[model samples]
Target: MSDPGGRGDTFCGINPEALQGTINSLKRDAGRLRGSATGFKTRFDQLGIDTLPLTKLLHVASWADDQLPMLRRRHHLAVLIDKGADPVLHYPNCPDMIMVDDADVSADPPKVSDVPDGSDPKLNADWWGALTPGMRAELTFLYPDRIGALDGLPSTVRDEANRTALSKEKGQLNAKLNKLRKDLAATKAIPPSNVDDVGGAIGGDPAYELQNKIDAVQSKLSGIAAVEQGLAKGDHGGFPHAYLLGFDTHKLGHAIVSFGDPDTADDTVTYVPGLGSKLAGAEGDISRASALWQSSNQQAPNKHVASIYWLGYDAPQLAANSHGADVASESDANAGAPLLRRFTQGLTAARAVSSPVHTVVLGHSYGSLVTGRAAVHGKGKLADDLIFVGSPGVGVDRASDLHVDPSHVWAGANSHDPVPDLPGPDPFEDLGGNASSFGTNPASTAFGGHVFQADQDPSNSFSSVDLDAHSSYWDSHSESLDNLAKITVGDYGDVTEAPQIPSDVPTSPTLVGPGVL
Candidate 1:
């Protein structure tokens, strides 16, 4: 039989006292938790710094290993596990995890009037009550019972007990807050400010961008290892794709996605991204984030708008395929027609009869060709608005050849961008204009009957173009974005001023250049 409160050779090597000591020590620092050394194995699989330890515990309890990281889990597991493991290993090691000793704070005993409430009865306004809530509660509960007798108990004793509990609670709250502060300090998240209202504010603050990048890198740093594992297993379910598109690549890609939106009332915007675009930490993603911003502004309250990020296909690198509309894309036999067909089909599938969609198709570069041909044959059907930007060709050189209602057609070109300047789809002999049939004629006017929009800021971001126009059309200070926002809300009746962009980037080319292509 086991000894009762006695150590005996008869008992196995299990030292209950040592085990209790371990439990108590951990509790002292970690809020009375006797973390299981065995159970720790289960937590070890979480794969990332569970900064909010509670979040990890919640996930651990809620999911199986298969449910661990949601989407691309196997591929992203390593990152998740690393993130989860961090809080467990690091948080308990913190010196301020709990402070039973009164030495860490100001030496003066907190006078009830001069200082705050004891927050924990065991604390007696001492400097040490700044632990965790659990720590405070445990201290409050244990101290009074251990140190004194409650004989001939009075109502006063009960009142004193309640006060002690509150103090304990305060102490625990302090500890938790300290932990939060430390984490914020470690990540160095920028303090929120009103400065973002001005575009110039982004310049002096290198910390803003640096912190953003660091956070991004750290978030997905673990994901890379996860991706490798997924690739090996040929499973990408748990992996999260994160892209960090530079100013130049994004400059081009942003133009591409924006051009893909239909410019008419029944317009549909299908946004396709380039390499390195994801929901997290990708510059392209942030650039695209503006699309939502612009759209929300346009969609004020009640408006018909449909937008989608076609993340279905992996974008090719500029080196692999600089021109998106090249024959290489459509040469697959299903080529031009089928791809466009599917897109229109999706729009048809997603429409509401009451709000019958007027078709507006926007194609950037190669996408223009896709939309261009789709409009011409009615195979993909003519949309009310067709936008072509930085396009090599829409399988034709003339806009009139597209066969859509010419009134609804539009085109845009940056001052120096050479894409539209290219011979329109002359290479693809299967299409047309091999000799001189020439595709749709360039609408060949200055944003006439077209709403030309681009980066208004003079910032050195690669996504902007300068046509040397003095007009506020591309000016950062212009109300263009706001106007766009209102447009989305179906309020085109009373034409108001454009939305103002924060002024920072220049609105003209750095060097004096040709005004037109």
Candidate 2:
């Protein structure tokens, strides 16, 4: 309220009347902004854009509406969305990003038959959010009708409406997208049973609420887009920024990242998430938030492992109560290959970083799905060891089904875990089966003749407990950890049991939870 460093004749005024007028003008602007936001939302719903992740869409819309009258960026964006004002025409630096089509995914047997080919937002937003703003306008262009419909509106109205709507929808979409993603990731987090001690030296599983921290980061550093751009450009030096590499059916991308340098550490760890993965999804798990990084940090402190969490596509969002072993292999394995591909690339990149990269790829539940995808695709074999914990299937019904050299593979499952018990269908695409011909407990299955180090978490006793075994790999003194550490250090993981995979008729939900992973 201090006179704002008043200049005698230069001030915009100190009169009560002037102040009142300024306030009234601001109110008018606010009202205009509010009205504009409302109308744009309707238009956005029409386009099937998720109101959640579309924050930028809305902001730009509002901005354009306010400025198109005076010709600003929004004004330009409106011209692009409405008048075919080619985005490339103006920016000339949009990088020619072609949004990938969501349809390319090989369709699975209809989980529900009344399908409309691809994901239906009102129905599927629970799994796949609406397309991204970039994809909406310039990339995918799902709403051709809407795009054509704009021709009916005049430039002034069109620009205002388009700007307002795009900004509003984009803003809302991002919000909803983040929330959905958080809930989805949280849903998959199966807490390690023993609350007492974990990771040997790491203490009680390091607590990191991944979403809260990542959200805080983007809020402070730059929005998701900025961070994504930096990663694409390799600009953020070791900050562990989030990225959605490429889309499959949803915006989920299998992610690969370098977490630390060998000059700094003696070991490395790769963490995989459960069903419904996203580029940032796995890392966002509350219990596992930067979970791998914790292991890297503890491994001799400054010396650390450059870890990557496999979050790229693996399967569709799961049902409220479904397990990976119960889902379709095509959905699980196909999407997973990219994640493996990226991991291998990251591994190669790690090697070039002037540090000896001792690597371990660890799978939990569908994480094992991704690892197997890599193995089947003939990749990820360069790692020190292969570990599967709380697994449903790793592309094989027994240890010999995998492509890796037998000595490097191993398995560990948590107590009373349900994942290992989920049904595997006949003529299965993955490795495990319950056929007595192969012979073994249903839960101990691992494809490709890989050996298991020892009984997982010897502290816990009791065989299968539903499908929980899908992610029990990290459960207490669970024997999987021993080999995980050994693998991280590049010592050959000693596998003793030459077990076979067990298969069962799938009675589990086909697709559950928020669709992703």
Measured against the true structure, the TM-scores of the candidates, in listed sequence, are 0.35, 0.43
The TM-score between candidate 1 and the true structure equals: 0.35
Alpha carbon RMSD to native, model 1: 25.1
Where does the lowest 10-residue lDDT sum fall in candidate 1? 242-251
Number of backbone-clashing residue pairs for each candidate, in the order shown: 57, 73
